[model samples]
Target chain A: MNRLSFLAPVALIGALLLIWQGACSILHTPEYLLPAPTAIVLALILNAPILALSAWRTLAMALEALVAASVFAAVLALLVSLSRTLDRAIRPLAVALQVTPVVAIAPLVVIWAGVDHPDRAIVALAAIVAFFPIFSGAVRGLTSADLDLERLFDLYGARPWQRLLRLRLPSALPFIVEGAKVASGLAIIGAVVAEFVAGSGGAEGLAWRILEAGNRLRTAEMFAAILTLALMAAVVHLCFQALEKRALAWWRGR
Target chain B: MTDVVAALLAVEVDYPGRGKALGPFDLALVSGEIVALVGPSGCGKSTALRLLAGLEGPTRGTVRRAAGRGETSVVFQSPTLAPWLSATANVALPLELAGVAKAEARARAVEALARVGLGAAVNARPAQLSGGMAMRASLARALVTSPRLLLLDEPFAALDEITRRALADDLLAIWREARPAIVFVTHNVEEAVYMAGRVIVMTPGPGRSAGETRVEAPTPRPSGFRTTALFRDAAEAISDRLAAATRAAA
Candidate 1:
């Protein structure tokens, strides 16, 4: 049953792609309106070098931003967990940052960092987009330790730092991993959106390539770029899923 | 005179908005003695144990402990083992917290697990253990430190009858071996009488000590002791006091 469930998604995706190709051929759909799967694949092969480079840059920016955001979130969560007053003071600001549209802020970040270091603006913006899930996850994780366990630690005379490291941190791992999975995808989106708005001159990220392809009326290449972004997001999601499985191997059930 | 491990002298505990929770209670635990606090729910049995464990402070009066911070331990009602850690690691936590080296702590933890008959399940997580095994692991963790004072808050109340009896026997054996001053809290009249040398009955609400019963049933209580007439009589007497205390509180 489990094996069949795993195969179902792969089978469904393949069937959808076949139907899409068949419809495109039968309807004589214009390539500009909807490129056939073959055309997109061909474009991907033909433009592999540039596409790969652009994909690499975007993935790198996303990854760097994810790492930075994780550290910031962990430290901030620790501070918030340590003091209720700080949590009350700073939590609303974090929520505000999370709710604001990243697209609106990308242009300002680009201007602030200047064109010489557009990468800085991209990283900053992506980090901003990625920060909240991890922060919220970690805060909830750190503070949600069982009251009995906390009292047990107290009775054992665990020092403050010992309690944080041994009990609180381990208890929070599953929550942190869950949050990171959500944040990883957002980090990529943030990177692409920032690139689209800021124009990554020499860097030429996948988002910029998409803009260039669209301007030149290369619809196949545009679709190819979108495909790469989807693939990157899938790979990021899968990696975190692996991490969650490995870290929480002890957890019972789903 | 035996050493007094801990004492609550006319101690009362009050929650800020919830009025008085427990007390004007007086109790003293001496070295190598097994004491049980028994009453109905909301009777502050746990509150008294917490006070002795130094987990909470008395609102009025004082609580005194001869055992220092690292010399005391508690086992809660549920198996409070860290779900993420293996049984061995959970047992090792107290020593690790007290600045013991990792290697030494693990060595001692293995010994503790073995003492509780969990030697074969050392690598298993709490989630992997049955209710009986998990509670055994919790007991190992509490006993790992060889604490001078051990406070147990209804540790076996959640187990089934067979597991509860088995665990009760295991606890008696462990207590006999270690001889720590123990304050066990439970609502089970039979368990209270079987495990404790002295059972202190408490009123139902805003709890206070009602009376004490001395169990003259002898130590190293045999496995079949629970069904014995002497055990039944002791349990019956404590149950009668418990009933009166509940009625008075009502």
Candidate 2:
């Protein structure tokens, strides 16, 4: 049953790709407009080296952004948990940043991060996009410790740091893992959208490749790049899912 | 004179939004004695336990707890073990929090777990344990520190009768070894009479002490003591007081 469940999605995707390829051929569609699955595969093989480099660049940016966002959010969440004043001060700003579209802010971020390092700007924008989930999830997780356990800790006269390390942080693990899963997807998207906003200014991620391909009507290459992005996102998601399973075995056992 | 481990002096707690939850109540726990607080739901019995554990302050009176760091331990109705940790690790936490070395704490935790009949399940996560086993782990965690004040808020209320009876006996055994001033809150009159020497019955919400029954049985009473006339009489007396308190409130 488990094997069949796993095979179902693969089978569905294979069928869809076959249908798409057949439709393009039957309609005599132009390759530059709507590239067939076969044409995209050919483009992928033809441009493997360039596509691989660009894919790596994009993946690296997303990963770097994810790490930065996770660290910053964790520290900030810790501060918020420690101090009511900090929580009151930072929460509104976090919400405001979250509510404002990342696209609208990308241009300003790119310029401020400096035109010379579009890579840095893309990473920064991605980090911003990835920040809120980790921050909010961590905040909720840290503060949402079991009340009975809180009293137990108090009875022991546990130091603040001890409570955090032993109780709050362990309780927060499932939540932080969940936030990271959501943030991983957003980081990829933010990097791509920031690449678009960064324009053709030497930023060399997969999104840049897509833009370059589209301008030259290399639609097959564009499709190939999109497929690569999807694969990367799926892989990243799976990594976090595996982590949640391995590190939080006890949580699921409950 | 008995060594007074802690006292609640005219402690009245008025929870914000829920006025007059407990007391002007008074309680004095003597060292190495087991007392049970029994009352109906919303009788502020838990509030009184919190007061003794130093988890909450009185709104209008004083709570005196002499216990310092790692000197008080509490077990709630649920096991309240950290699900991420192994049973040994959970038991070791209070000692670790008190700056004990990890090796020493873990070794001591294993010993404590063994005392509570959880030696075989030391590495099990809380989620993996049956309710009875989980509560035993909780007992180990509570006793690992050898606390002067051991507070239990219905620690075995969720267990089946057999498990509950077994735990009650095991707890008494551990108490014999290291006699902390045990104060547990429960709604069960028979359990109160069985486990504690003195059972203090409280009035309904905004509770004050309604009555007290002293069970004349030895510490770690002999097997089948629960069926004895002494236990029966004490249980009935407390049950009558609880019923009267509930009736008066209505």
Model 2 TM-score on a 0 to 1 scale: 0.94
- What do the candidate models score in CA lDDT, each in turn? 0.90, 0.91
lDDT of 1 by residue, B1-250 (tens): 4889999999998988888889899998899999999988988888888888888999999999998888888998999888878899989998988889999999999999999899999989888899999999999998988999998989998999999988888887888888889899998988888889999999977898889999887777866887888898889989899888877766
What ranges in model 2 sit over 4 Å off? A1-11, A250-254, B66-69
The deviation in Å at residue B162 for candidate 1 is 1.9
Q: Which numbered prediction scores highest in lDDT against the true structure? A: 2
Best by TM-score: 2
Q: Native contact fraction of candidate 1?
A: 0.70
lDDT of 1 by residue, A124-152 (tens): 99999999999999999999998999998
Once fitted onto the true fold, the runs of candidate 1 whose alpha carbons sit more than 4 angstroms away are A1-19, A250-254, B247-250
Best by DockQ: 2
Model 2 agreement with the true structure over A141-215: per-residue lDDT tens digits? 999999888888887778888899988998898888889989999999999999999996477999998899999
